[model samples]
Target: MKDIRKYDLAIIGGGAAGLTTATHVKRCKDLSVIVISKDAHISYSECGIPFKLAGKVHDFDSLIVKTPDFFDKMGIDIELETEALSIDILNRKIELENCDILFDKLVIATGGKQRIPQPLQKYIGMDGIFTIQTLADGMKIESALLSAKTMVIIGAGAIGVETAAGIAKRGIDTTLINRGPAILSRLIDPDMAEIVSEFLKSIGVNLITGNIPDSIEGKERVENVLISGERIPADIVIISTGILPDVELAENAGISTGELGGIIVNEHLQAFVDGNFSTDIFAGGDCCEITDFITNKGTLVQLAPAARHMATIMANNICGKDTVLKPLLGPSIYVAGDLLIGSVGLTSKRARSEDIDVITGYATGVTKASYFPGSSDIHIKLIFSDDRLTGAQIIGKSGVKERIDSLAFMIKKKATIEEMLSIETCYAPPVSTVVDPLMYAIKDAFRKIKART
Candidate 1:
């Protein structure tokens, strides 16, 4: 019989959430902390995979933030390539493959898993077909690309679009198959998505919209994708159909999960037990369903920043410091080719669907002075309910990511249109105009709101 190991805190999964929690908790108090990671490597940036594949980032090793040795120095025990087989929540024990671990407090940071369509599951691990969500997946895809000439990417989410751009940059003929009528439908409205679609096409990406991939047909490896009776030849296929929370382990332990398949946690990031919060167990990262600040409804915020923030709150609460996870505005940004796209809170399309009356203001301008040699076109769309800013989306080659972040903060603070318009933004001849685009955008929104009333 194996000996049962014990710890003050035991964390499952070692991505952003797990690592951040361990770091913060250890710093606050003396605690026996052990982090269980199923991955071959820990503390690597998952979002940097696309840029690394496209050669924008020179080395893959640079993506790793904390090595195993670093964690050791931080006084945290890490078990690499070790999986937690089961959880005995009532007994405060976890069953590993060969041993049992007991903990005073448990943190579930299992994150999410890539969702491959049922028809496409059989093609996984086969030649020419791949789903990327880890460093190893990126390495395998890069190795396979040496022999691939044409590629077909399913799903037009951020990863798929960014991957298409990377492949297109190498002059490979790439086709992006989007299940929805417009790409990034969840993040931006159709009009904003159209701008991105045009940008993708200009970079030589074949765009297919409103089509569902029916089957993957090949003798041994992926060779053709059949959609609506049309067979499209492909040398390689990458599926980025999004991810679902990795909640099986949590749910198996009697933890309550939401309708969206993510663990349901209270404002303190503790699991809901018998319709109440349990302080003994906590969950964060992509696994826990978070409250949308605007709607106050349970939603999954899967971005890295959201995970980090949740981790921080969980760490604080675990260390005898009362901290609560705040509602999220769901701000996100994506870079595709030379374009940077950003959005926060509700989209105009989403507001209308939710039956919320809203008006939008749109403005197009250059990132810098009109006479600046490298000045590029920028577009901003602001959605307002009455005189309060509800959401915003920005597309530009430069100066968009920070603006989206600013707008997200505004939404979080419930900033009115007047407040947004009066806030002074730094400007220079080469960097920005004396009058920021946001100022004009808010003014336009104000005018529209007046007309609507």
Candidate 2:
């Protein structure tokens, strides 16, 4: 007989969303909570993996924010290395490899898995080829880095580019390949990506864009990758193409998924099943599709911060609080060498793709007073639709993250150019300019709007 366990709330995932929901629920109510995770470690920062490899972070152990023991001490039952095979929606039971768990309410937060390009699918699990999705994967790459002399990273997304930069900084020859015409094509416009491309090159990373590898050649290990009929030698190959939501379990249980392949949930985070929203079943994180703040269309946001916010909303709803998840702006920031790149909402390219007519404004200034010792050049771009702030992109040695965050809020509130122009800003010689770069960017937009009208 299979061992059967029961709890008031059973969360199927221990990543950012699942664990956060578990802790929040426990704090709000005295309900018995259990978290099941397929991965051995949970509560670790996936974003820190590249930095750890680059020697910016001390070690992998430091990336872990909490352990299973900590959850146990908090009275939250956690099952590590336990894969949930399927869910019986009618019975409210989750079937696992070793046991069957019953729950009064359930939260699905399966997160995402690294997407392997079709050309390299067959070479998965082969020696010298890797994907960093978990602490275990990062540790393996760390070990392999000791012997790796040359590395080829496929996909020029944040992870791929950051890893390439980090590995190259370690003195390893690195090549970054992207199928798109520019790196971070989804995050920023080609113009902004050019800046990042140059920075990566300055740090010794070979950039290859607008091409796909024809084949990965090697018997026991990856020795070379053929791209554009050109063969490049490689001691290691890392795939950072993209991430797909893990929704097989939810689909198998007859839960509805959106066009983006993520579970369809309501604003309250309740999952839709058989064309009806289930009060007892909820979904969040990368596994669920959320609405875009500007378009109000379903989209998948795989960032950890978005996942945690969804988790909080889900927990609040479960605790009988009337909390709802607002639409997502999908703000993101990345570190490549000494540059901090950030973007929020839609880029000009994305807005055009969505058929949105937009006007853009650009400004270049210094992060601090020109005479300040460590002042660096900062570039800002603002995208506006009908004079309302829609998106922003910023690149510099510093001051990018906070500005992106502020712009995200403005976009969420539908701030207008006039409103942005009148906003107050703090100034300091060491930390900021007398007139912030964002102010200049706003002024630039205002000028464009005035000229057009």
Candidate 3:
């Protein structure tokens, strides 16, 4: 066989994690790097797609963080619209549809694909039906809105809620259908989700829970969604069910996958191949699973921050350095109209399901001083297992993200309820109250712990 095109590092996928790894490796060393992206456009923010669809972002192109030329300037090759066929581990080569390439090190960051239920698969490929996973997906939705007066979004996760808020803001009739008992069921508890549901209702958006899309009915495009026996009129339909890891390449290469269907990796982010850890192959991003900080369970966080952290650690080890990725707490925040929600670690519901003896405290206060201008109601819930802080959830228009970050740090440190009660918080009229809302939450949790003792 002839000599194949070679590189020091060949990265599959050009999403957040893959881009991070490529940039870090090139910046740290003189290694030749190339990134393969299945999408024609790479380096765009997937998280910002909903904002673009909602008109918060003026232009879709603005979401493109780094262009292909930018990466070329940084001494990295970006191959767009390329698909990886399979990996030949023994030969250290990857077979692409166009050509075969050899690499000293291989990084798999294939990201994720929007998971549509088998029942809903028949509705796809229609002009008015879409899934918001890429910039192209957003553009399609925007174009469809010209004739779409009503939309039915299935699945009330972050994407669904955000989309509903955005479409409703545009004076379009929007309805959010959630199969679970509450919106954001995976992120926040029902109590917190209740506030969100009410906010949605107050904004003139129809919020329906405990209902599933039975089917889509339309001629050439989506027209209505049938739930049970009710026929809900809709000009457009968005399926935001969830995402699943793109692990076909890894599995076809004879790589091991974890229980969660993501590529298995060690603490160093090295891929487990052939019954052992392989330094030459690494994986990260939504395509791999990590240990949950609180539950010690194999979980897929699928957050950009977590993926970036994993990429950094994987790159360091790939460059002849030693670095281990810590367990992920999956810190995340999302906006739904005026409400900002933040969550980290485990939820009280999840903790109890794990059979952990959890004590929770709930507190409500103003994000700013009571007398300050623009103060908003803030609700916090802190969970303690065996007197140690295990989880936190925050809901507010302002100061929610920052407070959740502090609580996440406490959980990472295994801080006790006593430590959390005394956490130092800055007080101000505009930014925070004299007593922070988190402090009140901790105090309540400590009181509950003491009472139990």
Candidate 4:
């Protein structure tokens, strides 16, 4: 009955969301927060793993934003290089590989492990097969790429696109293998993805869309991938298909789970333990689900930004501060070569899935004033559900991220086409046009919506 471990709050992961929640609670006298991370660093970015592989980051240290000393200064206890094995909620104890600890309020923030495709786990332990989720994964990929001259990446999402671009830029024979009909099949529309696909192709990378590898051809080491019954040579294989939530601890502790094995959480970010939030446990990040802003559907988007937003909500809720998390409007961006590809709100695919008759407008415009130097072509696509700006995408340079952020705010506020058309933005020749490209996108959408009505 002797006690050795105790904390007011125990965060189980040290990734983006975990760090945010810990930092938020650091100043509170009522909460003694400790973050248990398997990683050596406390607040490093996971999405930057691919960029590191491209020689963009000099080493693993450059990718780390903060050190162990930084967390100490913040008064947050950090247990680095410690792995949690399981959770015992009835006993209020977490069984780590090394020791056991007790927590008053538990935060399951283990973001996600890179998921190797199903039926491939037996082969995943094989050398040269990789999934980029952790800092370690990036190092492993970097080491492997030194010996590999050609690589094939599976998946067409943001990671796959970025990895392909990076590898091609490395002068490696890179090929992107996508099962979807288009790149970013679920995030961006076919037209916008086409822009991305074309960019990757232009950079001397082999691009394959609407196709898949039937099998890994190598019996010992990954030698080739069998697609269309033809064996394509490959020196390395990166499984970037997607990531699933890490729900092992939740399920074993008898916590309720949502669709796709995500930990079920209420508006207050509390777990649905004992049929209520009183279980004194909460979860977010890749481990939980959130309401998609446009469809009001439960979505399993495990992006870093989404996790950070959810972290703030979890912190407020855990501190007994009455707060609610707003639904996600799906604002996200991807970098492919020189293009800052991005989107917000809904996509054409999502609109049709809901049986909503939608009209869309597309314009290939400049990222800034046309007369400005370095002003490049930015193609925008806007989807509409009858005068309402449902979703939009931008494939451009210079202003892609900001425009996407602006569009995301509009979508979150439920601004109709009229409001979007007149959104007042600082216009300069270098950074923007007097007419923002998003406005052009929205005006185009308004016209299409009018025609549809």
Candidate number achieving the greatest TM-score relative to the actual structure: 2
| Global fold similarity of model 2 (TM-score) | 0.98
Off by over 4 Å in 4: 1-3, 424-426
Evaluation by lDDT, superior candidate among 1 and 4 = 1
lDDT of 4 by residue, 308-401 (tens): 8888888887887778877777588888777788888778888888887777877777767888888888888887775677788888766778
lDDT of 1 at 116: 81
Candidate 3 clashes between residue pairs 3 or more apart in a chain or in different chains: none
- Candidates in order, TM-scores: namely 0.98, 0.98, 0.97, 0.94
What digit string (tens of lDDT, one per residue) describes model 3 on residues 93-130?
A: 98987688899999999999999989999778986888
Across 310-385, the per-residue lDDT of candidate 1 in tens digits comes to 9999999999889988899878999999999899989988788778888889999888999888999899999988
lDDT scores in order? 0.91, 0.92, 0.89, 0.81
C-alpha positional error of residue 189 in candidate 1 after TM-score superposition, expressed in Å: 0.5
Root-mean-square deviation (CA) per prediction: 1.2, 1.1, 1.4, 2.1
lDDT of 2 at 16: 95
Sort the candidates on lDDT, descending order: 2, 1, 3, 4
Q: Would you list the rank order by TM-score, best first?
A: 2, 1, 3, 4
Give the lowest summed-lDDT range of ten residues in model 3: 419-428
**Position 206, candidate 3: lDDT:** 92
Better of 1 and 3 by lDDT: 1
